[model samples]
Target: MWTKEFFGTDVYHLVSAFVIYSMLGWLVESIYMSFCNRRLTNRGFAKSPFCPIYGFGAIIGYLILHPLDGHFFKLYLLGALMATVFEFLVGNLMLKLFGEIWWDYKDKPCNYKGIICLESTIAWGFYAVIIIVFLHSKIIGFIDSWSFSMGSRVCSLILAIVTIDYIIQLSKAFGIDIRERCADKYESFKARWY
Candidate 1:
């Protein structure tokens, strides 16, 4: 697969990892946000239950921090640094592209321009240790259980859904009313389900 050639992993493995991590990230963030705000919040750029930043961070940690696995302290420190950098970049990119930051750490102690903070970076270190040393093997094992063809097909379908959601969200960011344009069908579907 192209992912194998480019990322040194099969399509099923890489895409599954991305989608799974993204969903988990969304769940975590949504729960945290809902608790903080005392109301439910869907914490993601896309309307779908996926956070691409988390997926990218997980992949980067899997590839980069795997080498430091046995060195606990080193792994923690490096993971913190890596994740902080990634967070800073993504945060800034969103600000530049959308004239808004999806998350702000200004209220946090030791924050840098509200883009990154010390506490979050420290938590990221622990997260790296837990995910790499504890959770990753199980996640990989679960992914491995699925047949390649079936897993790839499912991943493809999910990617398509996420991509469409992303495009819709991007359009909204640019002041395009895609749902408004499709209001009849959208309302009908919502009325049926909700």
Candidate 2:
């Protein structure tokens, strides 16, 4: 019974795995940026860590590929390819429409034209690899045990973060001085109410 319980479905484990992998990707990129100590610039997008576009892309990738089984290596490769395509298309479209790049990898070894960094690509690839390997090996059966509610909650958290980040960025793009505006509004409200 204990053994069965230990191996039972645990949505928390799946959510934790996703969060860990995402955070690891951010950490790796931050380390790379720190070593360079230069603001990354590129032809297409703006430089930002909390890119909502990439967040959405990642989520999409998970949705599309997570249901498939068999041929772990092949699936991983296909997922990587899909991710790359998504990144490229989204980056280009954003540049064309908004005239800003959401990320910059200018100084990194794997960066090309500041638009796409090799580190990010490799990180995403590794993420897919981990999922594929784990699912195939059944070494950690937690993912299979995860509850739907837990999975939805995790995805919701990610989406909320991405939405907030995007809103901040849009405000920046429009040159809205949120800090100053908020201060002025607060002072006015205080004077009127008091």
Clashing pairs in 1: none
Q: How high is each candidate's TM-score?
A: 0.88, 0.52
Error of 1 at 189 (Å): 27
lDDT of 1 by residue, 1-194 (tens): 52554345666576788888999999999999999999999998888999989998998798788878789999999999999999999988888898889998999999999999999999999989988898778888988898877878888898999999898888978998887879978888999999
lDDT of model number 1: 0.88
| Candidate 1 TM-score over all chains jointly | 0.88
lDDT scores of the candidates, listed in order = 0.88, 0.58
